[model samples]
Target chain A: MINTILCIILAILMISIGGKRGIKSFISLCLNFILLIFTFYLIACGFNSVIVTLLGTIMFSYFILFYVNGRNIKTKISFVSVIIVLILLTFFISLITYISKISGFGEESLEEINMFSYNVNINMTNITVSLILISLIGAIVDASIAISSALYEVYENNPNLNRYELFISGMNIGKSILGTTTNTLLFAYLAEFMTLIVWFNGLNSSFSYIINSKVFASEFIKIILVNIGSITIIPITAILTANKLKNTKE
Target chain B: MSKFSIQRKDIVIFTIILILSTISLVFVNNNFKFYTSTIVKINSIEEEKIDPITEPNILGIEEDYYLQKITGTIMNGKDKGKIISLENERSTSNVVDEKYKKGDYVFVSGNDITGLKRDVYIIIVIVIFIFLLFIIGKFKGLLSIVSVVFNTIIFCIGIKLYTNGLNIILLILIESIIFTIISLILTNGVNKNTLSAIISVIASMLVLSIMILLIAGITKYKNVNFNGMSFLTVPPEAIFTAELLIGGLGAIMDVCITITSSIKELIDKDNNIETRALIKSSRNIGKDIMGTMINVLFFTYLSGCLPIFVLSLRNGVSLTNYIQANFSLELTRFLVGSIGIVLAIPISSLISIKFYKRGDAR
Candidate 1:
């Protein structure tokens, strides 16, 4: 309660100083709060991993991308592509979970869970996959948006351009964005856990196992999925949606 | 007469596929966590030298480090804030941080910018600068500020309400709505434009939500492993179904804003633009945005997980242990959020199309 009051006061103060930007910041704060709750709700419901994963993703799309703002292709496309990726990425997750057998967060987590009286299915491998995937979601979306917007702006400016021309334009834009976008995700992942990565370096571990092992392999698969999901969908979805919407008008 | 109508068959087919995918995701996710063993290790002993500069942190970072010259405020340590020398650490660097001294008051943790040998302040000064910039930007900044703070509070309270155990879907549904309203109100202001955007975002979020739940149920992925998440507070990713929840949160907002803004802009561009033409044009816009939007999520999630992989290359954590001890949060964030980004593209486009066409036909 006190924190809420403080938040309110601070928000008002920011509004006085910054106005619109301050308002945005304040909204971000609230949206994050609701997102946090939705997360908990999933956990509280006996660990239904699949449901939670899906719920979390949609909630993220709604809050982070749209903030339920005005109608724009920017928001709509993001939601659609994100959901589709959610469905498609399952293949990699399943494969990772199957090989890891580190279900319910490995032996350490299982031991703890055994002590509890919860009915939730605690699969460490699956749960860990969730975290890895979540982290990648942000950069992937950002990159996708940047590419799509750049392409459409081009097409909008040059409506006389042929479909082939438009697609080429999109690919050209996509290529430039791709390099940094990939780096962005890669760096973001590394930065967030640089210390832990450093810790892993000091540990007595193997290269082959690190690459092929469930943890490494799973994350590897996830990163690949995110990369592919973001980069792949941007052009294809953009083109198709553009084409369909275009054909309809003509 | 029914010229604007979507083909019933197409809608049915799309809906079926969506529902099926949702079911599949659930089944796959539930029973698939009992296999892999791998851990990426790290080893390092290199130091790079950069110019020394005093940095400060006030907000928007992982660790608890704020701006203060401790000359008068150092509770325990000796070299409080007295012209301390900066150290040379890692990825972080020292830049002119005027906000701490000039403005208000921030950490990535450790002496990333400063060395450990001498007292060093962890640098989230960049983030603090960002916060200061927000305060300086005024109204627009205030709106953003409102969003940041507002979202944080909603997240916390929502967590409590969920823990106390409310109707699960209701918690999500209500929060989504409130989130939409607040976001629009804050960013676009109280107007017709804001109202329209709010509606589109809500609609798009809802459809995507249905797809996610459907897939989770079908896939039956067991979501266990909720403990000892390495983070500043609680690893929201690991708590509850955090991976999916937070994973999808940012993307949802991204899509909502895009779709609404595009539609509003198109409508504003030419109020007489026919409904069909408006939808098509915006969708073309969506295509461009979708590509980049998807990548945004990719970077956000994948970047968060990169450190482990890099460290693995540097040191030698066992593959088995690396995946086991780590990799949960990062991987999930990527996949789920990516999925949401994909789904959002079509849903928002479709809704917006219907919306503008309605206005045009009238």
Candidate 2:
């Protein structure tokens, strides 16, 4: 019921945004959703989570940037920069996941697992790691596109701006985006777990005890780790775009 | 000091509130009582055999599990600073039950002996999180922390009302509106930009709720399962709707602020710019942001569903069954929230255009 209503509403809103552009955005988002579900299916079918995630990230980066901005140099730059960041961030995400001992912290699902009554032979740790990695991709892609386009505009408006000036402009734009993006990520976790927090409080759990809970720690680590990726992309994308734009101008 | 030189006062007020809250949090006695125990030594470990008749396993036999004889010192309560011995069972699955080691802090209950409660690791993590936030955000970070504290109080009150049999949806709606206004004011101050963002958020929510209602009515609200969310007290549908409202608010607010502030900047830069040009530029900016803002909603909502997804897949459930059983709520939220963001772009753009034009008219 909600899906149908959402689809209709999205269709109307998309058309209103721009007849063709709106439709394109709607289709692109739908495809992205399908790709996500497909990625999970692949993972379940015994494909490696990391490889599937890499391929999925590349596909999503292309689809979102191309669909939104089209086949411009700006789109290409954002795509390449995002991929580079994703490659570098994957190792970091894995290291953090392993060190934190956050794998299989699904104690909340103990009841459901009992109800299902199935043999648990899967690597619960790998799924946890994959989910964390998957979560970072969206933020990284978003940051890359925002910085690349903002820098592109800065360079466009000021034709004579050199590489250094353009890079500085990109950094300034990135700095502004940092706070809200971080909040978006943090609040996202908060919103999902608001009830759990309330439950803990009602039970008289101390702030220390609540934060140290497996569920809470898993989420907190995920938020910080993903934000680290989002933050790193800013400098890397800025330098890459600045270099690209400068070279193209020459 | 000028009238606007209120930063020092704000800091002073914030500090006092922080100190008071911290003291109250630590010193106040909780309604439920627990014995604080400090692990002194792991005395011994032994394998306990379970009766095959009582406990059956996949191999048609009971599995042996380890039990540790743990000795600890009571740090608080009537047995303050007293040594005690407890058996820590190492269960077959470590996810459900945990094993304790020497020098670890644990909580225990019961008057006679004691039942083991959770460890005290979360407190350390919270301390680190707050310290990092303050160090990175400075004054702004301080304000954000204050806003979070206030918001949490509101949410707790809202939950209290709900458990007391108040309407959860209404409580959540009111709480969300209040949270939006208060947090924005605290962070951005009272201004035209804040007003525009607030208006945009409320307007988008109104439209989104109408869509939800229509959809709920049409579909008769089937497939809305609350099986996995066994923790909720109220009706599952009510909690789900309330969560949807609260879950979408942050992303929508973020979008609204970005669009409003960006458009405000453009209008300020060129006051004589045509309305058509302003709207067009706003749409362009919205296009640039819509992808990631929507992704923010998508990823965040999906993260919560990851556990369920893993559980279902591990159980060898089919894709369709997984979607029906696990992904339904998250899928609804992601779609509804994404649509809210989609609507927010134009809602914020159009409203800011009006606000700017009205300001110029004055």
Candidate 3:
């Protein structure tokens, strides 16, 4: 009941304050939500989880960049950077998920699932990769777009700046945003598991045990990986945006 | 020549980080004896399928599953250097269990496989993250790392206090204040810009809290599901509210800092700039950040809930039940945090306007 009220309030707030762009953002958000649902439904219906996730993430980036923010030199460059980062991080995420064997539900959730059938015929490891990818796309898209647009503005104001200067300026802008971006990722991820941490505390779990525990390991790994994605995108976007902008001028 | 020198410095930093990461990775992988849990390295595994759906179930969705006879050598504990054999069973789904392979490390006690050894993989990722921070941010990266550590310590302290019977709402209020001060000061330093960001963050958070309170009062906290936290002994609503407070802090801080810093830049560029221009530019900056900032919040929260949502749906959970039992809390969280993000824009702009005028009045 309260959820409806909150949604209504949020929609009203966004549309009223944000105007046309706000309405576009709202639509994109709703579409993204529907896309996620459709992706999961496909995965449950026995499609390859990773492939579906890859396609879903692409659509997500497209919606966020083109549909919501619109296409331009900045969005184009950002979309390229986001894809590059996604590809690179995919390998890392898959490698870590496989090697760490942190796939599947944590032991703490074991009790909760006792009522459900376990023979769902899906590779939980692949699902882990998918979730990590989805968790990461938002911050990476945000950071890359921020860099590309900010750098575009620099290029607009002072067309004489070379690729190196633009690249450095992009890096500087990245530095200013990096701290708060990391904080955003950290706090957001950690907030999701506040209850679990409290549960650990209540159980008087030792520090070493908590760190090594499957549930804590999974959540902590996701947090670090997301932070890594957001961080690495900065330099990559800076370089890519610089080279792209510089070459176009000639 | 200067650009080349900058590139040289970057390469030097990259090399140092690369060497450090490799060393750390090697050290962590071999440090099994450091753990108190009995660790075993699987040497081989033999698997056989258990067929014939003998027992009927509600879902009636049975498939070929595996039963494994796993043999391994103990890497740690008193049974070190001894061979051990254990039996494991896994569904093809493997939702809560994993199939063990050769060269894998598993935690064991006697004959039962307890868990997997995962600390080494975690160490690898953390080292790489720190390396990137240093490579990109240089000294500020190091300071941000320090702030992260300090903030984590503060978090542990907060958890400790919560377990020791402190009021969670009050505790979180204090913690958020400390978090803002420490984070802004450490990353941004103590200056008017940082000061204004801090003021804006706290003020916006206060306004958000009041707004949430009013809404919760109107609705009487109805339909806010705490089923996801059934293990809690304390009031789940208080924890939920506290989570809402900290959840919004990051984006709020991002929006506040971006606006204030942009305003500060404009003021520094033209000290004689009029309030109208300042407001205009600040709103433009806010507009640029607002969409992405909200997207960041949306996706971050949604990721955590996706797996559970999928899992429940696959297991024949009705959509309404899933929404009531699991997603309501998530929706509330996302909505409230986003509202905080949006609210921060104008509040920070207004506060920043006043802040600059008072400090720079001549």
Best by lDDT: 3
Model 2 pairs in collision? A208-B123, A211-B122, A212-B121, A212-B122
Worst 10 residues of 2 chain A by lDDT: A116-125
**Candidate 2 accuracy as TM-score:** 0.80
Give the candidates in order of DockQ, highest first.
Answer: 3, 2, 1
- Which tens-of-lDDT digit does each residue in B138-214 have in candidate 1? 23433444554575477546655655656545665677677667655765579755666667667666665665565
Q: Pick the candidate with the highest TM-score.
A: 3
Ranking by lDDT: 3, 2, 1
For residues A179-217, what per-residue lDDT tens digits would candidate 2 score against the true structure?
677666655666667657655645767765665466767
Q: What DockQ was computed for model 1?
A: 0.06
Q: Between candidates 2 and 3, name the one with more favorable DockQ.
A: 3
Evaluate model 2: give its lDDT: 0.68
lDDT of 1 at A75: 56
lDDT of 2 by residue, B64-159 (tens): 346666666666666566777676554443334454555545555542222222222223334444544443344565566577678768887787
lDDT tens per residue, model 1, A11-63? 55435433454456446545654564355344333365456756776676666
What's the C-alpha lDDT at position A81 in model 2? 85
Better of 1 and 3 by TM-score: 3
Candidate 3 lDDT tens digits, A175-198: 878898888777776577788888
DockQ, per model, reads: 0.06, 0.26, 0.59
lDDT for position B88 in model 3: 88
